[model samples]
Target: MTSPLSEPADDVIRAALKAHGGLDRWRNVAYVSADVAFDGVAWNTKTREHPLSHARVTVETGEQRTVLTPFLGADRRSSYSPGLAAVVLADGRVERARSQPRAAFVNDTGETAWDELKLAYFTGFAFWNYLNLPFLVARPGFAVEEVAPVKTSTGTWQRVSYSFPREIATHNRVQAMYFDEEGILQRLDYNSEIFGGQPTAHMLSGYETVDGIQFPTRREIVPRDQDGTPAAGPVLIGMTFTDIEVVNARA
Candidate 1:
């Protein structure tokens, strides 16, 4: 049967899915939990130059609930769902957090409780979406189109442009993903509307298989120059995930 996506787009998508384990196996996954180390300019921007921190992240894929616990200092946890978000403090106080997720990204005005909480929600939702790629692209409502191939230092990469529904958690509604010849995702390009339309080039590497799925353990995001080249500067956001556990609710 012909796919709903363009022929070239569908071919690349199928190749990517097969390389990362089939769609059927991914659909069977219920939840994923991981220990992650996060560091970068983005974190520093939020925490007044605080360095790398360990975090425990959990995502209920079926229900789209994401929770993140940062182990740098306070004993607190942040959780986000479709329209609601909350931060649980050490004393078991639940603070209602509000975020305009789709708003354009802006420079840090000043650190406030609500701003910190909103960052938590944004990071949690962003990582959850990042951890589940290609698979997430296969879901309905995403429009995929094949773009002209681009030659990088590595080789020619097949480019796929995506238009996501507003409800999907992502930096922007329109983004581009590049895949290697083996169908592994190499780079992602998007404008962070929230950060005032900052264009970024996010590179994914260090692939590891967990529960029949291939996931990139290391991610590095940097600002992109006008020509789409990575700008020379500290990484905007860098992260590595370990101790990943994908739980199958259907099992």
Candidate 2:
């Protein structure tokens, strides 16, 4: 089938796919599992202060289910699915839950029960989208166009602006990705509507090959200004994934 991405953008995407492992290799995978350590300023919005307890996440790719353990507080698991979100405490009790997206989450008046779980929903889906990158852009309902090159201290980067279909769950419907000469994704730019439409810069580094796929072990997301330059201050979110596992659906 013909790709939606422009010819130049398609070339870059193909190089990225080959660098990561190959579209066919990623397409065959049914699920991927990894233990992740989550921390950053983004979490502060939920707690109203810096967090002390650790957060561990497990994502199911095909099913689109994200399970967050030790979220907000210890021994708590927040499971976010398509239509519903649930939080289970240590004692096996469903502490706080919600059935669907709410209107209140759109406006940032203050945090509420619905807001908390909605954040979980956003995180779950955002991570899933971030983990699956160049290949995901090739999927149906996604459009990609090459943008002007970005010159940095290190080198000039090839850029591409892409958008997700409304049906696809992501932090934002449209975002831009920057790749280095070798086709490794170096940065991602987007305005996260979930976070008040704040411009964000997500950096990918510490690449590790897991099961023949190149995965970024370290990720840092920070606020960016209107000019797409990094904003001053600490990062919004910093995470690292370890203990990676991938299983093919066909297998």
Candidate 3:
């Protein structure tokens, strides 16, 4: 027997792509970069390479550091690498660590995922589709289901959710996605609770057309706390890309 979930969602997805960027534009590009800001504060910068899934993101405040050569495809090969470490709270003050020391993180949507840098890398690559451009070309890998009507300050949003399988080197992994009614990519809720007890939500806003591409100038991440409070408001940081250099002009 055939399942309705397994049926083609091409029309719905195609609507989203059109509202996002347009298939013709998306299919013509390779790599992209963006410049971001928040309330006049200079946040981090990001650049991504596609078809290869290699991402290089730099976070700067006083110290400027970068994550290089990260794998960003559906294979889930390399998440966070050795050099990709974190600083976490120890006793009262914060302590520097090589990686996430926790076992699992409880996200806003009630899902848990492994806490690691590799997961973060995969997240960046995943968001590149909606955040960087409205159009994306990739092998369809999941069943789409209309979830619910999601309303937000932006507008009334219709939503459809989808999921895919990921085989972590030693663990099993799965990713879920949510798209708006207009077919706009709205939110991605991941279950990797390795950072904290909260799910990490990578969201995009301030959509505007630039150079024929729909790009969001603002990127915000909200991570949940142990007791389930949305913790502090976003870090008031902004991201932007400039001087974008495409690796292969004609790939």
Candidate 4:
């Protein structure tokens, strides 16, 4: 095993980690809990919106785990990990479970409405990967490539394309993430395989520091064209995180 510093994309990754907070501070964190309100064209297109209107979400920092409370009802919660997704009682008894949840989305185009279990799987993997960017690139099993710098009104942004290993369930492999010269994340581009390979771009902003970590408070998504430029029309998914707290990692 080689040190991450020796990797090709180390410079950019390290810059991002340092600008957000050192890896040391991130390692001590167990999870991030926040109250988020989700809305946008994505949800509005669904048969019904996810029960996530003003819900609380907790995402594990070191692993691919997430829990969303008040999921469909006030007492039920959705639990997710790389291998499984389930809706469970407050006591954690599984009311439903889907092992190998990613497989369930095989050939799935998220354009159509989804059932309860499908929604659980989608919510789980989506946030689990979304909240763990830039830093997660340094973790094992991800192949990172520093791409060409892009210039925009915001500033000159550095882009890195990340390929996820099989062990992780994510929106798509080879997602390109953009960071400002200051190393803060600004946008992301990828084709959501589950959504039938529709190209999409995530425009991120509204940063707030918690426990010495810089976290994004707002995420806006839009369609992307073949050239990697974001669409100017309707926003796909608009997510805002509030009252975010970084919990200490367990001993």
Candidate 5:
């Protein structure tokens, strides 16, 4: 059966599968781990621990990459509180920033990635049937639309843009993604003030094979406008993965 999104030019399904690690490998995957870095600095490390039910995440930053997960029933729907008094949501109901001691959270109503990260898991928004992908996959209202291909340093690829959700999280904005014809995620573009360093645009390319799974090892971030166009003297940042753990079926 052809999906509603199926068309001659819209061969994104076939392209997506082959672009990723392939069907057999994608369906069989359990968990994944990658050493993450930014600006030549080992800023952090990340792990996507997936169970048959839901996925968990452990992100290490600062000096060491720490292993942290939602406190179970505590994190439901659109709120996350991990250890101590860290609270994150798409509605700005809780206060948890170390810097913002008394800044009452202003409810701005839009797409937010900070709240999305609290739930763990990354990408897999459109491809993976929206199951066992990441916390962001279940965000309240994300508008997905297929757009024209945009030229990049790599090559021509199809683009899928996600609009702002009705609710707002700790992070104000969200980054959009670009997928290739083979459905392999090629580039991700977004404007993140919290993570993108400076109001910047980010591009992830150079997909390589590691442990039989196709992963984007090289990522570049540069300052850009709200539309993702690089500014003058665009700074190029890079990241590479050294070790990886692809799901533990026994555990």
Candidate 6:
């Protein structure tokens, strides 16, 4: 299912895409929607509601767009882009919106309490970036370079350090992704600038296929030690995704 897009940066990148499904199948996908449940000390740190109940998320495939329904015990939802983050009403009215959303996090650390807008920005921005995954590398303006592989008790994982355009709202512009030998994504490393550069490791597992793509059903976000090991601390954010549906661009 090769599409018209040019080849990815290298064989490793291509292998990742093929493991997911393919760059071509990804090209025809418009969005991915799922039922998400979240828990962890993360909510307490941000001053948001702890133990978020299930929420429906729809994230765009080709760009940064994420919508979470019934945001925090309300009838309204939230919509997010790099430029704007909003609490939107059922009838298409915006209850509140913040432009240049990332700037609003200035001077904030993980210890700082957050308002709804900040919550929306961070949550939506993160999911948009996360959902895009290795596929994002296929697009322009991303610099991908193979890096030293990460080894663990189970096996060694091939890794790559990548940089994207400055405008993208991600955990960090420079980050690393580790893939299993089969080319499936396994772990991610980055420092969250909004939270005082908290070293983070996002480890993913329990893969299940949906609409020709592989998605991790379980996610663990935790603090990374100085040596790049997952610190023996809190599972900062534990997520489980279910009821996933991928919408095709052609549809």
For model 4, state the Cα shift of residue 120 in Å: 1.1
Task: Give lDDT tens digits, candidate 2, residues 55-77.
Answer: 66666545557777777777787
Q: Candidate 2, clashing residue pairs?
A: none
Superposition TM-score, candidate 1 onto the true structure: 0.86
Q: What TM-score, over all chains together, does every model reach?
A: 0.86, 0.84, 0.50, 0.92, 0.50, 0.94
Clashing pairs in 5: 15-181, 15-182, 15-183, 16-182, 16-183, 31-247, 60-65, 60-66, 90-168
Instruction: Choose 1 or 2, whichever is better by lDDT.
Output: 1
- Given candidate 1, what's the lDDT at residue 183? 90
> What is candidate 5's lDDT per residue for 58-125, written digit by digit as tens?
33111112222332233422222222224344344443423321122134122222233332212211
Badly placed stretches (over 4 Å) of model 4 are 1-9, 47-51
lDDT digits (tens) for residues 180-232 of candidate 1: 98899998999876565789999999998898898888989899998887777
Q: How much is 20 displaced in model 3, in angstroms? A: 1.7
lDDT of 5 at 38: 34
TM-score of 3: 0.50
Report per-prediction Cα RMSD to one decimal.
Answer: 4.2, 3.9, 12.0, 2.7, 11.1, 2.6
lDDT scores in order = 0.74, 0.74, 0.40, 0.82, 0.40, 0.84
- Candidate 1 accuracy as lDDT: 0.74
lDDT of 5: 0.40
lDDT of 6 by residue, 65-143 (tens): 8999878766889899889999999889899999988898887766787888888888898888778887988877788
Candidate 4, run of 10 with poorest lDDT: 1-10
Model 1 alpha-carbon drift over 4 Å, by segment: 1-9, 49-52, 70-74, 89-93, 99-114
Residues 32-127 of candidate 3: C-alpha lDDT, one tens digit per residue: 543322231112221111233233443211111222233333322332322334422323222323343222222322222323443444343333
Pick the TM-score winner: 6
Number of backbone collisions per candidate: 6, 0, 19, 0, 9, 0
Clash pairs, candidate 1, are 104-193, 104-194, 105-193, 105-194, 105-195, 105-196
